[model samples]
Target: MKRLFILIAVGLMSTAAFSQTKTDGVHIYNPEANAMADLKAATEKAAKANKHVLVQVGGNWCTWCIAFHQLVDTTVVLKQAINENYEYVLVNWDKDHHNDEAMKYLGFPNRFGYPVFVVLDGKGKVLHIENSSYLETDEPGANGKKKVGHDVKKISSFLKGWTVAAVNPETYKSK
Candidate 1:
């Protein structure tokens, strides 16, 4: 009986591990991508739009990264803000650690955590390395325990703060 129980536990653990590697559902992380070219394309798009490039670094294996992508997809205002101010790109950081050159160029921002953000100007200059954890809020749950999740308002503010319009010379000139 003990052996059977151990087998069952091992099977469950394996299932969980296998699930983590699967990208059958909605996932933004693509570990096999050529991130440098993607970033260049996004920068070009940003230049055309007169916006900045927001690079999201993480792998599909990260639950928080998935959650962040889902939040952006579902939240109307947040999506609009991103659409207006930035050309978004998702760069994969998997077990193989692909895109090392791109990550190195961006100063290795994955040191913060999964789902870290880096904003680049249209000219491809790094402007900010945003830690997504700072955009999350800890609220009390129904069970009276703290639960951390994305705060839409905080993310919107972050987007707005890093936008081209926000950094324009005219805005600074008045001050």
Candidate 2:
């Protein structure tokens, strides 16, 4: 009985570590109205804000995608970086199939491999595109320290570089 209780306690504790943090500034929606006007309205808003539209393209059934989703949900740094720079849009391949522009921009998933991730500029232009590169599977007991996908430090570093006043690689080029 003691062993079972301990196991349950550990399981609950483990779950606590991988849950979504409170999102205060994240715009967690896309404008898909099955019509032109609503889509244009959303697009205009994106343009006005100069926000990067991060389209996470995957089927609703993908566990890897779900893990990434959970990681984004749970990691505070990930949320911070994302909330500051981008408007997140979950482009469902199975149900929604709404990322036609992003798919065309990426051409094909070559770098990170499938599960395409697209970053679009304020004008609805493609800035960068990426793919899934899971360091370790999301299975329980998977090494947390070695998990590269949601490493807060690396992600923060990238955000810092991408958003600095004069050295932002996301916008300007040194010539």
Please report the candidate that would top TM-score against the real structure: 1
Off by over 4 Å in 1: 1-26
Which residue pairs in candidate 1 collide? none
Give the alpha carbon lDDT tens digit for every residue of 1-175 in model 1.
9999999999999999987644457557767778999999999999998999999998888888888888999999989999988999999998886688999988899999988999999989999999999988778888898766788888988999999989887877754
lDDT of 2 by residue, 1-175 (tens): 9999999999999899777454334333333423224334445666677555556666545556665777778988888777777676665444455456444554543335435566656665666666456333343346544433444464455445433232345456656
Model 2 stretches with alpha carbons more than 4 Å out? 1-42, 95-102, 105-114, 134-150, 158-175
Q: What value of lDDT does candidate 2 attain over all alpha carbons?
A: 0.55
| Alpha-carbon deviation at 23 in model 1, angstroms | 7.0
Total colliding residue pairs, candidate 2: 1
